[model samples]
Target: MGNGLIYVMAVNIVIWIGIAFYLFSLDRKIKKLEREMNDPSH
Candidate 1:
């Protein structure tokens, strides 16, 4: 039972980490687009 609980916790942590990274990447892309829209010179 203890081993199963550990595995569940680890999986949850990994999923959250993945979500965090995905959101971070998406934010960067959105910011870049906003910058380009604000300044067409680029």
Candidate 2:
């Protein structure tokens, strides 16, 4: 029973990490777009 709990916890952590990385990538893309939009030459 303890092993099962640990397995579930590990899976949850992995999923959270994946979600965080996805959001981080999206934020980077948004910042890049914002920079381009604010540039006078764009």
Candidate 3:
């Protein structure tokens, strides 16, 4: 039973980590777009 609990926790942690990474990447892309929009050279 304890092993099962640990597995569930691990899976949850992995999912959250993945989501965090995805959000970080999205934020970076958005920032890049904003920079381009503000610059006339782009």
Candidate No. with top lDDT: 1
User: Where is model 2 more than 4 Å wrong at Cα?
Assistant: 40-42
Model 3 residue pairs with clashes: none
TM-score per prediction, in order, is 0.90, 0.89, 0.90
Off by over 4 Å in 3: none
Worst 10 residues of 3 by lDDT: 1-10
Question: Which candidate, 1 or 2, has the higher lDDT?
Answer: 1
Candidate with better TM-score, 1 vs 2: 1
lDDT of 1 by residue, 1-42 (tens): 687999999999999999999999999999999999999999
**Candidate 2 clashes between residue pairs 3 or more apart in a chain or in different chains:** none
**Candidate 2, residues 1-42: lDDT per residue as tens digits?**
686999999999999999999999999999999999899587
Q: What stretches of model 1 exceed 4 Å from their correct place?
A: none
Q: Give the TM-score of candidate 2.
A: 0.89
If both were scored by lDDT, which would come out higher, candidate 1 or candidate 3?
1
